[model samples]
Each structure stands twice: as structure tokens, then as C-alpha cells.
Target: MTDPTLGELTVGVEGLALLRLLHADDRGAAQVARAARMAETREVLERLGREPSLRGPLGVELGLREGYARWAATYDGPLRLFSIEEPPVRRRLEAWPVGEVLDAACGTGRHAVRLAGRGHTVIGVDQSAEMLERARAKVPGGRFVEGGLTDLPLPDAAVDAALCALALVHLPDVAPAVAELARVVRPGGRILISDVHPFLVQLGWQAQFPVGDGRAFVRLHRHRVTDYAAAALAAGLVVSGVEEPALTPEAARTPTTELVPEATETAYAGLPGVVIWEFARP
Candidate 1:
């Protein structure tokens, strides 16, 4: 049999690069490559497309370039929608008397733009270049650095206040990142974090199709509220408040709802889809 054509080899190499970026593990990439040989690349790609992470499901087939680019492009829309509606949250943020603010994990610059508009000097940091690109377009005045939560590029005690909105849930261990946030802010500076309630994280979601007796196919990491508080404390931050804001009764009738279903909405109504916590470095 003739050897595979150069185009086929190029495709396979591209697949390998995608696998490497998705897994960030050499052993895992090798295993995925072996599996792809048994199953066609197209089939592999189809499976990964369903997952949130690059390595998720048919991710290998999607290839690194396309998968990463798509993630960067689509991330801004949902983030803006979720953040723009929280007027109370925004109000509290505006109340803080700080000239310099660091919006850590500031996806799409929703909060960053708001803060900048209020005349505060803001620096937005995020790992995804695509997200940062969108954020830059939205808030040209605010400085944006492309980096992870655990390692902020800013100097020590660089900012008067730091805000992390709906971004902690993505990190594997919230402690180190929290510590980094605390370290960057001056003594008595405040840190605000908002994320999905722990209960919501525990209640897993089902796929459209049944997989393994119709059980929840994916289990998201649900870090406890107390644990998060402890992390803040360990990082030398004093917790001031923890609140679960209510969705207005009138706001409920709107066609675009943040709540998923009756049960979920009820649960979220009692417990917030967003939890806001305030901390101060002593």
C-alpha cells in the first residue's frame, strides 16, 4: 500500500498539535493519538466539540488552531450578558473609594469598563488572549494583561482594590489564586469575588442524549462556601460579607432568563446564581 499523502500527514500533525494544547500532557497526547488511529479524526473531533475545555470530547479532531480561536471568539458574548445585568453589584463596586483597581479574570471587560467609566484606573487580567482581545476592544482605556489568576503580572500592593467576577470556579484550586489576589492589593484594600453557588456546582447537568443509565455525565467542581472563605482567610483577607442577591419579580418575566428551569430557578431564587463576597487585607 502507498504511504499516506503529505496533506494527510500535515492533517495528522495538526491533530497532534491540537491534542497537545488541549491536554497539556505529553502522555495524554500520545494516548489520544493512538486512539485517533483506531477512530477516524473526524469522529474524534465530533465528540470533543460538545465539551467546554479544548480536550473535551471531540476536541482532538477540531485541531488546536480552530478550537482555541473559537473559544476566544465565543467567550465574550455570554460573559457580557451575565455581568451587565447586576446593577446592585455594580453599585457596590462603584461605592468603593479606590482610584486604582485590578479586575482579575476580567472577561470581556464588563466590570473593567464600568470601573474605568467611573474614572478609576483599571487593569484587566485574563489568560485567554482572545478574551483579552475582546476586552481591549471594549475598554480601550483600561490596561489588559494576558495571564492566569495564580500569577498576576502586576507588582506587589499595586492596586487599591481588586475584583474577580465569576472567574474562580474555573480554577482547580482557588486558594493560590486568591492568595495572589490578596498579595497584589495593598493593606486594607478590598477584594470582591462572584461565582456560581456551590449547590449549583454539585447539581450536575445531563447531556441531550442518555449516557450510562441517564446519570449526570459531567460533575463540575463545586467548592464549598466555607472552604472559599477559609481560603480567603488563609490568604490574609478578612471576610466582610457574603450575599446571594435576589432576581426581581418583574425581571423574571423577561424572555432571556438566567435561571435554567422551575426547580433550578426556585433554588437559585433562594440561593443566588451569583454569590458576592467582600474581603479586606488587614
Candidate 2:
């Protein structure tokens, strides 16, 4: 019952037992170590814009929320994706007129703290209370509320601006969440939504986390650029700007294989790492 992802890693004979142990729901050191290695390797693959295997727990016991419940504990730690995404989000925020802010799917207050620190009245919303607890601690002034993207617990046209960062990938479709985002922001207010680039998600990169001893992969939808545009159009949110920010100039052009394999570096070097949408309610 080894995780299907291990087939890609081929972690060697010593890792077979580890994989089996993880498959059996045993979170022992061997399993944990192997899972961590796999996750790191997957991250490297994802960075190179290759599709990483997304296999993990598969059943009701392994719901996305449950996995995040475990992932919430370390949601704000040092990870490549965080570093890759945070800067672009910050840069995008600079162009917007900020006031009351909504941090939809605000995990661990990572971006919320920064936005709040910039003097925006930030309200962080997430499904995981465990994640919200850390968010609350990170930005005491920012309101932390437990909610999902599909049904946000907020008044209509309530906020001046909104942000849904790297979260729409979890949804089966972007429309529901986009509608919610549109519903909350006042007319003329801006909404900045960032996500794993459609190209990367189409390449099979998954939303996952190393939780407890085993790994947890939340189900994700592969959304294209058109899907986002359609959702916004249908919701009546006017598109103001679309940004496809790449990795830092040095890293994107370096052609280095220190982290990723040579083939992947060749394939994806200098490519856009994330997709950002700036929309306004008219």
C-alpha cells in the first residue's frame, strides 16, 4: 500500500519499508523521513514546472480539511512556495487602493499580517480554526474568522478590497469562490486573486502538505486562465490587470540544477511561477 508518489521517487530498498509503513497509517520515523524527502523532491519538481505525482491518503479519513487540520500546525514555516509567492502578492498589493481588506483563505495569517501591517483593516477568513489561531496570533488587529470560500460569512458588498491568494486551486471550480469574492467587495473595490499558475497545475502539481508523520494531499482542480476570466466575467467583476510574475530574475535564468533536475530546469526556467488577477466590482 505504498503511496503512488513513491513510485516516482523510487527511494530505494530502504525506503520501501518506509513507504509500506506510511501506507499502513504508521507515522514512524522511517515513513516520516521518506515522506519529507518526497515532499521536498516534489517541491523541486513543481518549481521546475513539471507535474509532480499527487497520490496520498484516499478516503473520508483523509479529507482536505482534516489534512489541513494537521497542516495548519506548520502552515507558516519556511517553504519554497511561500517565498516564491509572497513577493508577487506584496508587489501586486502596492497598486491597489487599500482600506477594509478581506483575506479569503488566509492561512496562518502569512499575507494577512503583511497587509494588516501596511495599515489595511484586514479580516482573515479560513476553514481551519487551527490555522486561524496562528493567524490571530500573527496579526492581533486583523479579524480571524472561520469560513470557507464558497460561503463566506460576511455581509454583501462589505469590504473595500479583497484578496484570495493561492486558494482557488483547492476548489473544484473557481466560479463559486469568485462569486463569493464578488459578493463581498463593494462596487468599484478591487479584488486581487493569486493562484498556482494554470500551466503548473495542468502539469499535475498538487496541493499537499507534510502533516504529522505522513503526507496529506488536498484535492485540487486544474483551472486554466480562461476559467478564471469566465468566473470573473460571470460575476460582473471587471478585469483591471493580469500579471504573470516569474521567479526572481537570477533564479529564473540561472539554469541551475542545484534544486531541480537539468531536464526540468531546461523546460521551465524563467517561466511564470504564479498567476495574478486584479478585478474590480463595477
Candidate 3:
């Protein structure tokens, strides 16, 4: 497969800007912004036509195994989404009665460690063995298993609650995983899920992180709001609440910001950065 080009990425960013500007509130200022974006896109296209290096490979794209393995060493380091996703999720998780909690796709036991500290018996399950190793060390008393979300390595109705964080976007279809999460929780139990919002995905969000001297990105699937609703209904889980956290200025910075800071900021401003869902088994 051909790696995406730097020029292509820049053009994509410009395209995103144009898309947002064109569809946003039809005010005179919006029209001005939309026209400016079109002009910027044309200039970028002209430069791409003349520059050969810009058309070359951007960076390495890795599969989940290789990507997360390389990421495990630094995965616990400062992460932007963690700040946006964790607070609301932790509040809901903490409110639940202390009991067995399944942290599905629980990379490096970020949530598991905290839940364990709060006297909850946390069981963290992740696909990456490397991540699980870190999770084991962090929460020695908590159980850590190498498992996938769709086919969890646990018995049915084994946990009182479940939390799947920033992992569902990796799956092409979220239904199976939703059903699996439901299967593992007892009736009347709750499940909380957090992920990069579909709007961000449409604007080119992915599972990206540092690897060695460079960077690697794992492709993310676009799951619309309806998709989550259907999955929950099919799994017999009731949607209690949904939260869409808007992007903060700090979290909106991107690699392309250097090339077009205004476009980058404008593209992401006021957009939802993450989506957190609360579900109850009925």
C-alpha cells in the first residue's frame, strides 16, 4: 500500500477546513472564511504540483501489534486525550458500587490502577501483551489478562461494571464488542465507554503515538452516533447518558499546525474531541 504523502496530508487538512467552513453557520464572516480556505487550497495544490519531495512518503503506518508494542514503553507518558476522556469516565466509574470492574482494552492499566486503589477489584484486559505487562506491575493485586474486546477472556456476567476506553474506534464494527461487554456484566450493571468522537474521526483523527525517533498511526474506523445506539439496543443495554467533550485549544494542535496554524485551529475549534457513553443493562 502506498504511504500517504506530506502534500496529500496538507491538502486533506485544507479540505477539512473548507468542509467545516462551507457547512457552518451561513454568516457573512463564514463566507469570508470559506473563500479564504478555498484560496489557500488552490495555493497548496499548486505547490504540490511543483514539489516532488512533498509527494514522497510521510511516515510509517503500523498494525496494532507492532504499533502498541513500540508504544507500550511510553504509553503512560502525558497524553492529550487522557485529560479529556478520563475525568468524566472516572466520575461515573467511581460512582458505581465497589465491586469487580472489567477494564476492557485497558492499556497499561490506566483506569485499572485507579479503580484498584479505590478498593475495587479491577480486571484489566488488553490485546497487547507488552501493555498488559506494564498493567500487571502497576496494579499487582489487580488481575491483568491479554484479551481482545470482541472475545474477552472472562466468564459471562462476571463483573459488576465495565469500562472500555479509547479502544472501540479500532474495531470495524462495534456491535460484537458492545455485545461482549454486555455479556460479561450482570443484569442491571453499568458499562461506560469513551472514544474519539466520530466528528474528529471525519477530520482525520487516528490512534497515533510516538515510536522510536518517528511516529506511527493505527487506522480508526468511523462509528456514527447511530451506530453506538444500535449496538447498545441490540446488546440489550440502555443508554443512560452521552457526553461530547469539546476540543480545548491545547488539544487542538496538530502536526500540520506549523504549515497552517489558522486552518488547524479553525478546523478543530468548538468541535467535540471525545465521546463518553454510559449504559445500563436492563
lDDT of 1 at 7: 32
Q: Please identify model 1 stretches exceeding 4 Å from their true place.
A: 1-72, 79-85, 205-220, 246-269
What would the per-residue lDDT of candidate 1 be over residues 1-282, giving only the tens digit for each residue? 442232333234345334434543477765665464335445434544563333323112222223334455545434322642466568779788958999998867878888988899999998767778888998888899988789999899999999998767766678998999999999978998887566645642111112233211212356887878989989989998777664433322111122112222222233344577889888
lDDT of each: 0.63, 0.72, 0.86
lDDT of 3 by residue, 1-282 (tens): 787777887788788777888766767888899888888888878988888866775567788878888889988885667777888988888789989999999999989988998899999999999999999999999988888999999999999999999999999999999999999999989999999899888866777777666667888899897888899999999999999988876677766677777787787867899999999998
Give residue 7's error in model 2 in angstroms.
3.4
- Which has the greatest TM-score? 3
TM-score of 1: 0.64
Off by over 4 Å in 2: 1-3, 9-61, 212-214, 247-260
Prediction 2 global C-alpha lDDT: 0.72
TM-score ranking of the models: 3, 2, 1
